[model samples]
Target: MASSHPNVVTLHRVFDSPTDPYVYIVLEYCPDGDLFSMVIDSERYLMPPEPYVQDRSRTDGCPVPESPEYVEERVKLDNLIKTVYDQILSAIEYCHSLGLYHRDIKPENILCSADGQRVYLADFGLATGERYSTDFGCGSSFYMSPECQDGAGRRLTQYSTAANDVWSLGIILITLVCARNPWKEAVLTDDTFREYAKNPDFLLDILPISRALNDVLKRVFCIDEEKRCTVSELRASIRGVPRLTASNYETWERLLQRGLLKASRPKEHAQVPVEKNTFSNPDTNSSPSPSPVHSPPNASWDYGPKQGKFGQGLGPFAPTSSDDSWRILEKGRPR
Candidate 1:
């Protein structure tokens, strides 16, 4: 999945060893926590103290940041929940744009950044799309899309279109606000999972989400392949809340425009910009690590005070920082 969409998760390095399970993976860590945890700890997240446009603090009473005791909680639960959906939509769209389908799209598997800038769709253990395929279904029965659960009994072909991923995304979106699986009620049999897949609309309508969001889910969660949305279509459809899309052209432009903006930014300020750090050629080194610079959001910061690190990245050895001994401050602390 990282190969397809680097922003999905920052894969630090790929290692291979002749150890048990054949050590082969690119590891990473999420600074914050998963979406489920964020929701479960609802009291901890307050809206900005000031208006959201200019600042990013909580609006209600300007509660202490993440302070369990001072948080204002929210009067309306819908906005925070919608944020989760919005973030997931952004990640899912990035994957789909790469011709990939995150066969897995459940909340537990989705991780949030420490800064809350984005959500990541992790565990591509069973993911597939364009140049990839797996015999196993990637997500829990509760979130499986229709195509992933029907036919030939647990076989991969049962429901394996890009739309299948959208179906699972729909279930996740509903769960964001409702906080429980809606299908849990209708799905009674042992194959309750299968039963849920049998009727997505009936399951969705049960929650009473905003009419606009509901409409988007209606299309993505459609049981029939012909009516359902593919990764690209699903992304464009949900570009705006309460409104699927302004029109086809508008949707494509937004998607394209985002891609253009991301590509145009200077490489280093990628990965959904935090603050920013510039790397001189010396830090690049020999080996092949995808410098933190590849992800796209890094280029938007004021350049200077570039940080240095010991690393061997993708291109031939090159100096990474101006100073011979410069260390990046990781959070705080001189590195």
Candidate 2:
């Protein structure tokens, strides 16, 4: 546990008993809950209550001024995003310095403080020390990098773990501002991601993110892991961003007119289509499909096709069960 880093969850101790088969880990308590809940709450602050409907009858035709309360809430959310994002980046940088890579980076893995002003990066179950790893399809599908997915069945010997972490961070940022995932998975089989692969700017047509943030995501999501933006570059780009979502009513209206931003709120969860049964690998044992774990109200979890032992994949919001090797525990009372 990288407890020295303020943004990383502190690990107090670990207990292993000869009689018991499970190993228990004790971690710092964060009562405010995860970032997914914060994002859901911020959705209202991103836009005004009423849609920006144009009226030609009125002589003084301008968007109504936002209430002072609305302005205050928006400002608070903006500052929170900046603070949490900066802290998360610092935590990742610290981990990378120690020759570690967190394969799972998502809102659910981020814990918040009592005042909602602090965040801690947790769940390093999938983390690895190796810079390059052959563990394909190892993370949440929604936050996975295109190269990591290996949808083409290239049978890649390994992929850069650092690059994969950056890609997942990009997705987390998008969800924070837009309250929706950019795509179901970073693979050609998914229509949204495929469109993005072809046109880097396609996200602008579907999501309500600012151009600056979109530019950052474009670099972060480079198909070539070797060319993807590093954690340092990502921090710089984010600091330069003026706003996460559309800055003004005019910008929001323009996107709406272009059939980009929907009048109603976006769906809480992404609907993934199930694929038909495929031939199982003779070399590996087959198992039943795992039941979709219960997730938070607005949290998104990976339910894509499971890869075989040595197969190439074609395709976290909740505290879902992991493999038998590890488990995390909190010291304080539950939130």
Each prediction's whole-model lDDT (CA): 0.46, 0.64
Q: What's the count of clashing pairs in each model shown?
A: 26, 1
Give the CA lDDT, 0 to 100, for residue 108 in model 1.
Answer: 59
CA shift at 29, candidate 1, in angstroms?
2.5
Model 2 global lDDT (CA atoms, 0 to 1): 0.64
Q: Write the per-residue lDDT of candidate 1 for residues 240-273, one digit (tens) a residue.
A: 6742212222222333454532223233334323
Using lDDT as the measure, which candidate wins? 2
The true-versus-predicted C-alpha distance at residue 283 of model 2, in Å, is 46
Candidate No. with top TM-score: 2
Model 2: C-alpha RMSD to truth?
A: 13.0
Q: After superposition, how far is residue 154 of candidate 2 from its true place, in Å?
A: 6.2
